[model samples]
Target: MGELDRAIADYDQIIELNPRGPSVYFYRGIVNARKDDHDRAVADYTQAMQLAHQDQRGSGDRKAQLQGQADDPAYASSADGQSIALASGDGIALRARGGAYAAKGDFDRAIADYDEAIRLNPRDKEAISARGNAYKTKGDFDRAIADYDQAAQLDARDARVYFHRARVYWQMASLAKSLTDLDQAIQLNPKNAYPVLWREIVARRSDQLSEAAKQLDATKWPAPIINLFLGTMTPEQVRSAADDADPVKKKGQVCEANFYVAERALQSGAKEEALKLFDLAAADCPKTFIEKQAADVELGLLRASR
Candidate 1:
């Protein structure tokens, strides 16, 4: 906040001295961009580019570069001799434009600009990361993965790259890859809860019940959510598991009691009660077994009625 204020103050002074100066406006535009005022940033950048073009119209190197006759100064300090004074080698202008376009959801422009930035600086990991993120947002998982891969190769230690890659993998339904990337992200930044949540979802989807349960226990996950899974035990299975439990068993006894109630309801020809039990079984039973039990009960009822 303090930095932004200082930057704004500096921009104000520069703007006052050179009311039509592109460089001053460009500096201010950066501050607006940081604040997420993208519209104003775009306006400022446009104006800056125009002013730079006018400044460069007759200059030998700058004009030649604009005319495609020569290379633009890769590192020009003078805002006075070019339409845009952004460092050519670093592709700062292209990257900034790409980011601004992305902010506005103009992905085509963003990608084009990013392409230019990448061409200018093959090692611009920030541009690579931004482009990857843009592709992810556009639901182009393959492109996102490509960009993320390059970004990761450029800077393997960046946790954000791993996180974005995981998201792309998840979107592609590549569960193993998604989980692997998520685990890497977590290892790199354990404080981020996002990877943990994604990992939990993956665990559930994979039917790793014990692992999911342990994660829930270890992480202080909500009890109700855990119960949502456990509560799926069928009344019959609950009862059977409970009734045969040794005296040393605690939860099994309670499960058995619920099972008895469920079984009794089914025996009483209460279809709703039976279905409820089946639902509980679906939720609580092992993925390999519970699904069959639920399906069989449902199929039996359907066929009997027919």
Candidate 2:
């Protein structure tokens, strides 16, 4: 956190030195977004877009000055390269601001931004994937899948797209399809623990516990929580592993731990206990965590069924 604060301070100095530099504002916006300061991130991204637009217009002497700077060996090798770089920067700014909007739950606005970013750079796999996420959040599953399909075609090796698409499949109750995508994602990026964790849940939900247990044995996941998932660690032990000094961290850990335990309880016919754990997870977990999102979804279905 201190490092991020110092980085922001440095960006401020750079902005002061080059007030018209869009890249500095864009980078600062990224930092602010990471800190969950969405409003500031939006403001900085807006400033970046405006600057990028002004740069694009080839404003009087500004274009000539930029071209001259490009001639410097320290900058770009040629003016054309610099122009391409500047144009790409605008697309990046749009996509980044779209992400901030998505984080704020303004899916409509986020989709609009992602659309424009894609228009500016048709080959932007990240923009396409982001648009899919916004569509998923809006419960437009078909459109989300379409975007994910396009993203996959654009970059077949991107594990994140597969992971996200798997989530949408899970939400759609296409457990078999979700499992396939999750399997592909894990195969592509074995080091990413998130896919492994979700795969275990999905496998169990699909009544493939034997397969899940086999896969779990072959893959080594980190920490007390993985032990909880394997039924080797108690809920109390999982809770103990959470950092007590940090309320937010503790809440996130406890939320995730309770969510997994709730799943186990549900499987064991302890419906009442499962409901209690789900309620605690939904109430205490950070909204940004995937576990909280799943918890909320589960709770909604539970209430609907009742």
Candidate 3:
């Protein structure tokens, strides 16, 4: 077994021995979350939180011991939110449970958890960013932008926050602001394909597509996508390159191809055709991919316009 698996096994044995041990449940939740088992992770965190709450009204030493469980290195899920992310000592379980809820497409509950987390620790920027993402998915762009603004003020180097804000601007049809945020995102994380891809797109809409090729650097997988935007590769070629031996990864790449191409078509004013491709993207994208959320947003926006 991998280290996380062995750790989980140990935690399982511990849980069997001391079923009421909140620390064991919490640590197991962390291991399970690292394994991408978000459901179990959420359950563990909930149980931990319950036990901690119950023990809080006890003797001074016991209360202190329970409070000591909060630590900066604690994490419940990943940034992609097929889980949660790292947190500081305050309200860790709530921050983590919010992530699990987001990963499960339960934005309202996620937002509630994030609200509590932020109330407990106003400087929890990761939870703030994840909350922004949840708001974005829920079609609450204004609130999403507000949260991202807070997160950026808290940590200017967070590339995904800029990316998230860029998408929000794109949604609002503020293409210039979207391009500006995408520029910041690319400047922060040059190798991230999402911002690079969207920068070309937003630039195209701004009639500045020509200089996009200057930003290109060749790489695997998404290199084909970059080439497609540069006019050096066709849609068919990009799709062909997206084909992979790993079925799960292949699904995401193909979803990206459809979404990007559909976006290009939308920019080119091919509304009906873009709708068809977007449908494919929405149906095919992995649940954890930000593009899947974007695809759903696109579909919603287009349908509302119709």
Candidate 4:
């Protein structure tokens, strides 16, 4: 928080000097978002979007074009070489604001922003997939599926869209479709054990656990988890195995261990144990992890049932 605040102060200095420049506002918006002040982030992004649009009419400079043109200064600061302006139009600011709106639980505004982002760049698979996730969270499953479908068609090899779509399928109880999407995701990104875990889970839901077990690697970082599901390892062993020399990876592994164990407990009809493990998983897992999201969903469902 200190570092983010310092960055925000630096951005404030820049904005003070160049109040009309959209780039500074755009960067500042991102910093505000990192600080979890999503409403403030939205305001900054809105200003950036307005300035960027104004730049199109030659009121502003070339450095402030939407998503910072090909030579935009914003791209120069990126660690992953991806410009916030992912497309040719005003997609960057829209997507940024959309993300802020989503973080603020304003799904309607988020969806509207995403809609414009998609219109500006139909090939922006990331934005489409994001919109799909928004729709899924809004419980408009059909719209989510449609967006995922478009995203898949736009980029057939993107493993993430398949993985996300599979989760939607799981929620809708379309077990077979979920399994199919998870299988595709696993095949495309074999190193991602989450897809493998989810595939096995969906398979178990469909009573095809034996077939899913056939696909387990049995020799990897998550091998302990696979062995647990296979009944070859105990929960204590899974927890022990989750510990690692690297604290970061260890935290994620432990979280995964708890979540997977919770799944097993649920499968065995041990609702109380499942709830306990899921609570642990939800608290331990990073907010960004799908495991955390699933744990929260499971907790909600279980409590609602009671």
The lDDT for every candidate, in the order shown, is: 0.57, 0.72, 0.76, 0.78
Encode model 1's per-residue lDDT on 146-183: one tens digit a residue.
99999899889888788778866765679899889988
**Stretches > 4 Å off in candidate 3:** 1-14, 21-38, 54-90, 205-217, 243-248, 265-273, 286-288, 300-306
Give per-model TM-scores.
0.53, 0.79, 0.77, 0.73
The C-alpha RMSD in Å for every predicted model, in order, reads 17.1, 6.6, 4.4, 5.3
Per-residue lDDT of model 2, residues 1-306, tens digit only: 436678899989999889998767766777777666777888898997788678855543443544444443323311101111222435656777887787677778888988997897788787888888778877899999999999899889989889989989999999999989998898887666667778877776433333344444433323566666666778787766765555544666677778877776776777788888899998876544566667777788777877
Instruction: Pick the winner on TM-score between candidates 1 and 4.
Output: 4
lDDT of 1 at 51: 69
| Best candidate according to lDDT | 4
Q: Positional deviation of 151 in candidate 3, in angstroms?
A: 1.0
Task: State how far residue 290 of model 1 sits from its true place (Å).
Answer: 35
1 or 2, greater by TM-score: 2
lDDT of 3 by residue, 104-144 (tens): 67789889999998987798897898889888888899999
Full ranking by TM-score: 2, 3, 4, 1
* Tens-digit per-residue lDDT, 1-306, candidate 4: 237777888989988888988878877787677566787889898897787667756533433454335564434332111235366456767777887787677879889988998887788877788788788877799999999999899889989889989998988889889989998997887766668778778777433443455565667778888778778899999999999976656888999999999999999999999999999998888554568778988999999988
Best by TM-score: 2
On lDDT, who's better, 1 or 3? Answer: 3
**Predicted structure 3, TM vs. truth:** 0.77
